[model samples]
Target: MLTPTPTIEKPSNLVAFAFLLIAFLTGIASSFQLPTLSLFLTQEIQVSPAMVGYFYAINAIIGIGLSQILAKYSDKMIDRRKVILYCCVLAIGGCLVFAFNRNYYWLILLGTTLLGLGSSANPQSFALAREYADNTGKESVMFSTIMRTQISLAWIVGPPLSFSIALNWGFDWMYSIAGLAFLFCGLIAVTLLPKVPRKKMEQNTPLQAPSNNQKSVIYLFITVFMIFNCNGMYLINMPLYIIHELHLPAELAGTLMGTAAGLEIPIMLLGGYLTQYFSKKALIFTALWAGFLFYLGLLFFQNTWQLVLLQFFNAIFIGIIATLGMLYFQDLMPRQAGAATTLFSNAAKLSWLVAGPIAGWLAQFWHYNTVFYVSFLMIAIAMVCLMKVRTVN
Candidate 1:
């Protein structure tokens, strides 16, 4: 039988609303860069696809180290607001640097590393939401759902806007807009955010070496790593595949990605309701099974319309996995919200770090279709690991 823990006090509705708004703005800033990044790297900057992977891998490596350090500090301080503030400032600077220095590969690499470190804001935001809910008697899972939904909504809007900007103003303008947005977000964070009390912020138990919880966290980390390995291959390679393999207009790639993210919004909202009826285990199983089938289709689908249609399935798999993966780790160690969320976020970054170079090498030498096969295998392995960990449901 599970023992119940006491809930912490919740922040005022206004504070919560502010957090959500900040989440949306940051999401927009981050998403706008995604649809056009590979295009800018290869077409405008004239870098090899393999080089794109290496650059991103380096970025993720920097993010892993910086985020780990920041998360630990937030947990100890019991205040994520400061970390979020720092991230926003970094985002603003990095985006501007990336915007102006696109021609120099070394500069671009440095800017991307800073942006990667800044993106740790995503996990910190989730942790803050959890802490707020604990204090307010709100559901942590539901807040997570809402937070993720806001990001999904941003994905829907950001991509189309990014595509239009790239088409009209030039790709540099996309980074410029993102930089301004990040600056605005930083101002909001500094002026409006509240602080958690020392007592409320501290972990329930006294400081000690990690318990058995660390073991399960490790297992879950591997699970998340594999899930995102599949994601890295797709996000980094799909635009290139569509442009090079299918010979489609570059704008369609953004449309396809945006459409999929749009479809994900409802799924994310539905996740809150689903948890009331279906077990987390059941939902995660559904997602992995859907993913397995979707990646399998990637090997066969050649037509643009077919790939577009596949986005619906991809949206479902991605939405569920992203939402549940965070909640699962938080559930694993409820007290260390900062550490848990950061670990889960790092799992994805770490996967990208590894997958980037590997996927690039495969696509460079072998074939684009080969990436899908590897992704499918990764998803299958994640499913096997999920089956073994009965604690999740």
Candidate 2:
């Protein structure tokens, strides 16, 4: 009889739990800016909507191009703790710039670029989680679970926190609080993360090489880009739709969005379990098809409740797709964790880069419904692409 291969024992749950806590805190800090950043630009800086969109697009551009370079460098360096510490410090500086600047447009643009550089932590956190998994011999399930939980917590906490801060204290205080949060997370990471010995030259590999597998990896990146484009379009445009088209109050729009996000948390946790039983490709396909239907539902939405219901359904499917896609990409480039994460992160940035300007232009020329229709078409294309993908495992 053939013997079954023994599963690798995972590292201590205590360490994993601690890492998850850090991930949660990081997510909370990062997310606090997303809902209010554009509003800050418009209200505080008195910039045009077009300019605000442009500023975000530029940030995405910088992040997409620079993340790979930074990740490659990070892989070679021994002092990852120090690297993370510097990212946090950069975030603090960016926040300070935003808090102090009175000229809205210049401050918004400059602050966002600096924030873009700091936001590279998104990928670094993933890379670090993967490293933790490797060191502990834990399954990627643990990593994905931690990530989804952090993201869900951010979605749940960030909007209310941001709105409250922006409503009562002003945008400056929001940035200040975000800066302090980053500093705190950095200090915690510096003290708690275990130091591993650096590998010698022979053990280390070159950052880039052309190979057959590399080409396949590129294809995977394209798929990731498509999925994120679908997501980014929804996130960037939907709020505007709720406030402007639906004629809902800003607070109500935020609440509905928050509710949709809160629903996603359970779906994400369930997704972590489902990945063990189902093929990743199948789960992705299901999510894509479901997302397409959800977009279709948006076309028929007549009231706030209708839109909220659709958003709730959409969130569940999107959560599944997001978690599975992360795992799938990690599986594709097992060795180059940083590079793989950078590629995934850039896909997200690329989506925002494309979505912000395109959505803005579309909203200007046509109706917001047109944007939803376009998103439906994109999700359909994504579903087809996902169906055609060969199972990686």
**By TM-score, who's the top model here?**
2
Task: For candidate 1, give the lDDT of residue 214.
Answer: 62
Candidate 1 segments exceeding 4 Å error: 1-12, 39-50, 102-110, 170-172, 198-210, 240-252, 300-305, 390-393
lDDT of 2 at 181: 79
Model 2: residues >4 Å from true position, as ranges?
1-11, 103-110, 196-203, 208-210, 243-250, 387-390
Q: Per-residue CA lDDT of candidate 2, range 1-393, in tens?
A: 111211123235645665676677668777888778788878877788777777777767776766677777777776555656667777788889888886755554677667766776656766767766775567776566657677777878887888799889988898899888788767765655544344565138776533545665565667667767777777767777878887877666676667777877777788778877888888777777777778788878758778778876677667776666777766766656667777777776788877776777788898766777887777767766665555775
TM-score to true structure, per model: 0.86, 0.88
Best-performing candidate as measured by lDDT:
1
Q: Residue-pair clashes per candidate, as listed?
A: 5, 1
User: Each model's C-alpha lDDT?
Assistant: 0.76, 0.71
Weakest ten-residue segment in model 1 by summed lDDT: 1-10
Cα displacement (angstroms), candidate 2, residue 383, comes to: 2.7
Clashing pairs in 1: 8-135, 9-135, 9-136, 10-135, 10-136
Superposed Cα RMSD, model 2:
5.6
Kindly list the per-residue Cα lDDT of model 1 for residues 1-393, writing each as its tens digit.
111222223246766677778788888987788657777788778888667766666667787888887777777765567788788878877887877786656555678767876777777778877876776667777778888888888888887788789889987788889988877776766655555544653655543225765666776778789988887788778878878887888777777777878888888778767998887767877888888878877778877788888887888788887888888888777667777888888898788777777777898898766788898788878887776554644
